[model samples]
Target: MQYRKFGKTGETVSALGFGCMRLPILNEKSENIDVKRAEEMLNYAYEHGVTYFDTAYVYHRPMHQGISKGFSENVLGNCFQGAKREKIFYATKLPTFVIQSPDEFEKTLHESLTSLKTDRIDFYLAHSLTKQTWDRMIQMGMLEFLQKAKESGKVRHLGFSFHDELPVFKEIVDSFDWEFAQIQYNYLDIRVQAGTEGLHYAASKNLGMVIMEPLRGGKLAVTPTEEVRNIWKKSQYDRSMAQRGLLFVWDDPAVSVVLSGMSTLDQVKENVRSADSAIAGTLSDFERSLYAEARKAYWNRTVVPCTGCEYCLPCPAGVNIPSNLNIVNELAMFGDVTLSKGNYEFQPPSERSENCVQCGVCLTKCPQHIQIPDHLQKLTEQMK
Candidate 1:
């Protein structure tokens, strides 16, 4: 695996970090993790040179059936049993949703350390932070808590994983004397959450920039769209869609690490191979144009630009806007709507668009200004 300088830390980490949030599970249960399978993949990745492992409080967390909050630190801790712990960097998060009090900070911090079977975390972040969470963190004395953690030697680095608008993201970045940051970025999200603008802005300040969804949650890893294929066919270099997605982020020298939640040994092998080839400014001017065209073809796919931002939430009528629009997009993104439609239709009418009340409240809230009621109305008719 290739390595990069982690911002101003003067420390080096693998170009590809292993995201342990999606380990293979047994019996279709999130808690019933198929550890043996996971160990093989994790070991393969580690042996090949991946040095950073990222997990979170809710990773593998099961709030309901067939769902995963995926508190993956447990698996990673278990996998790194015995002497395996000293070989790499361990990164994880403090769940923002659980931060209601100052006392909860230490409680969770210790719990995380215990779960990982480690005394200290290399990188600790405020997981999935939004404007509200940022304010609450300060109101509840997050600074004191982090300072204590650092002084106590429980946390080596401070960071945050963001999921908000650009302004809010920058606000949080500037508010804290943070060491690193994790963001959901990819070729497809150039103008979405914490887009390229935020990426470069954070990097300019020399924050160790770690990217979570470099492939847009695996959407960009699939076979290309016809338009995308046409563009790729013109390229002199032969690369998989996943490689293209990953390389786009690595092309920028500012990015420190890219996280891939590999679920299989094959994925581990494939990603490590890509990481071995990653280099800054590897994409030539022509290839960059191809990237532009590929991104355009991606947008042109049968999917809404609704990025599941959840800004327009708590619908009075109980409509699940993100899920519906995402499924709608999957009609094109995955090239098949059978599973999407099945899942969408499986939701009770209340959770589905049939409950849209046409209040227009969500419209003003949406960053994309998506006509929520209209989209729901159309989806209701189409799904029926």
Candidate 2:
């Protein structure tokens, strides 16, 4: 695997880090992970030089009674049992939304340390930080919590995973002396949350930039439209959409690592192979043009402007706004809506857009300023 110097840390992390949120699950419901199988996949990644592993406070979440969720960290503890723990860097996050008080900072950190069966976290992040959460954290004395974690020697590096507007991201980056940061970046998200501008700004500040959602939750890896496929097929390089996605992110010298939430062993292998060729500044002018053309093909077909940032979440009416919009986008992309309809139905009854109450609260929160309720009403009609 190719390695890059993690900015200001003097540590060279593998080009591909393992995002542990989407492990192979025990059932179609995706609540419980198949631990033994996941461990084998993770073990393969570790042996193959994926030195970074990331999880979160709410990943692999359990919703039902006795569903046995929160396996992300526990499974990592098991996967890195014994001397394996020293072989890689373990990264996890603080659940910023649920922190009622400043004291919960240490409380949650202690819980995470215990769950991972480790004394110190190699990298600890303020999970899913938005402007609202950052402001609340300031009021709750979060700076002290950050300082204490470092001074107490419990966390080696401090950073955040971001999901807000570019201005907000800039504010947070300037607010603290962070060692690294993770953001959603892909070919399709060049102008989305945080976008290319934010990526360059963070890199200019010398904070190690770790990329998440390189595949847009596996959407970019799927078969492209015939037009987009022809563009790739006509290109000199025989690269898959997924490879193009990974390569585009890695082409930027700002990107320190690209994290893929690999669910299957095949995904791990494919990503690892991609990592081998992921040299910074390697894409030629023609290749860069191909990515631009490919993105145009998607934009030509895309209906909604949503980037799935999920900032307008926990809808008072219980609608899954971002995901529902993604399904709706499939219609414009593929010229069919069956995938959208199926995906919309697959969402829990409470999370489906059909439950929208047209309250307009999401209007104030959405970065794109979407008329969310109005769109949901139209989508509900289309689905029906």
Best by lDDT: 2
**lDDT (tens digit, per residue) of candidate 1 on 111-194:** 899999999999999889988888888888887788789889999999999998999999988987888999998988899789
- Which parts of model 1 have CA positions greater than 4 angstroms off? 65-71, 302-313, 338-350, 354-374, 377-384
lDDT string, candidate 2, 153-187, tens digits: 89889999999889999999999999899999998
Q: State each model's CA lDDT, in order.
A: 0.84, 0.86
- Model 2: runs farther than 4 Å from truth? 64-69, 305-323, 334-348, 356-378, 381-384
All candidates: TM-score:
0.89, 0.89
